[model samples]
Target: MAVLNEEQEMLRDMAREWAVNESPVTEFRKVRASGEPEAFNRDAYATMAQMGWAGIIVPEAHGGSDFGYMSAGLVFEELGKTLTASPLLATTIAASAIALGGSEEQKARWLPKLASGEAIATLAVDEGAAHDPAAIETSVSGGKISGKKTFVHEAHGADLFVVAAKDGLYLVENGAGVTLTTRKLTDQRSHADVTFDGAAADKLAGGGDSLLDDVLDRARVLTAAEMLGMAQQVFDVTLEYLKQRVQFNQVLASFQALQHRMADLFADLAQMRSAVEAGLQAVDSGFGVARAATIAKAEANRVLHTISNQGIQLHGGIGMTDEYDVGFYLKRARVLEASWGSSSFLKDRYASLGGY
Candidate 1:
């Protein structure tokens, strides 16, 4: 486990308390039931911004706390526990792009709004069903960007888009020339295929050739943090369930076979936590980020898949029902697993990074 500083511990505790009391899984249920395309409560997002969560990675001069990636990961993990739905992650990823590659004018124009949650932003990359930044077909010409980005996260609520074109990243506001086709995935979160038909774009031209990869590393690490939280919650919930659920005239938790199964899950969860925390720390330290992020996300994909399945099996039939909260974790896990990179994708990338 990563040793947290005093402030980090406080932040983690506060997020945990708020997610449990203020925005529990029931809130996600409400959002899902509302059938809104945004799929998250606007007021809830405003509260998060007010709490300084929206700007954790933003520079202090730009109205953010500049707490770095690990701090942001802490909040993400807490929110993941209760399946809290918000655009915080998407916005943070976009903000990181600007902070890394945006011109001074670009920062002045967008970072403060992003930090204060006065504006919503998202990254538009990958124009396919799978994660593939290298295959981006989006292109910029005459200060306009034209192409489609499939499954853009938080698309419905975004006020700005940090888009990836063949040449580089660009900023496109949500207005004329930008069209959205809503996509409903398993998690029922806000997603859309965005068509940028000659949308005016401002290029971000400062982070050198590796800017996109750096931003993506941030996304992968932060996402793994969220998965860590979900895996932990599922393990906790399943363990508690086993203690109470009786089978064959004895408590299921007491069964040696079931105990061993849970023990295995516990070990996997521990490894996932380590990889995720190390990834977050690596981002903060600016050390071997690509390798660390790949390992973190790969571990997250592997462990969460197993734990979510085991959560269902240990609970027997009830785990599949909507009434059970464990089912929600599984649904959300599947979507996240496919988001930045799948296990196979990360493994290949890791090998390439190692020059194998």
Candidate 2:
């Protein structure tokens, strides 16, 4: 685990409490059963905003504390443990696009609302089956954007969208001509296939072609934090199960083979933790951010896949059932593995950047 200062520790603890008490996996299961209209609980998200989680990385002048991305990562890591379904991740990334490249006027207009959680925001980057920003077919002409963007997280209830086009990023509000088609994922959360037809959009004041890469890099880092948390949860739960589950008149944990597998998982988890922390620090300090983010996301994808599968295998038949919460983490882990960028895709990107 990364060493956190007092404030970061407080943020993590508070998020942990909220995830346990207010938005546990059971809460998410209930939402899934109830077929809730929104992707996440609105009331709970408002409370998060009140706690300043949504604006953790925004500048104080824009209704934020300027706490930085590391603080945001700390909170997100906790939220990931329970698979808390809120717009916090998407919102933070959207807000950051503005902070990273938006002109002062754009920041003034959008930052405060985003910081307060008064606005729910998301990004629309993927245009095809693959998560390729370079494949963006979206076009901007005459101050109107027309294209289809898929894999749009939180689009079911997003108030704002920062859309990537061939030219640059554009702001498209939720209204006529901007249609959101929700595509349910394995995790029972809302992803979207959004189509914009002659929708009036404002080109992000200063955001250009490069802004997409910047935002995606930040999103990758935040998502890696979540994956790390999930990996930890799976490891902990599986380890506990091994201790209690008995076979051949001996606890599964007592088996030498199982212990060795767990030890390997522990080492992988440590590497994941280090990668994610380095990515956070790199983004926070604006140095080697792209390399750090790709490495983190790639390692997280690999580690999470190994751990989640191991968790299922070690838990025996019960791991495959819906009654088991461990299975839930596995489903979410699969979704997150392919999110933003897949493991293979990220590795290719890293290699292209001269990484061996």
TM-score against truth, every candidate: 0.99, 0.97
Model 1: residues with Cα > 4 Å off, grouped in runs = none
Q: Residue 29 of model 1: what lDDT? A: 98
Error of 2 at 69 (Å): 1.1
Q: What RMSD does model 1 have?
A: 0.6
Clashing pairs in 1: none
Give a tens-digit lDDT track for model 2, residues 1-356. Answer: 56789988888888899888988889888778877646688888999999999889999999998998889998888889998888899999999888987888889999999999899898889988778877988998998899999878889879999999888888889897898777878888878899999998877757555688989999999999999889999999999999999999999999999999999999999999999999999998999999999999999999999999999999999999999999989888988898889998998899988846
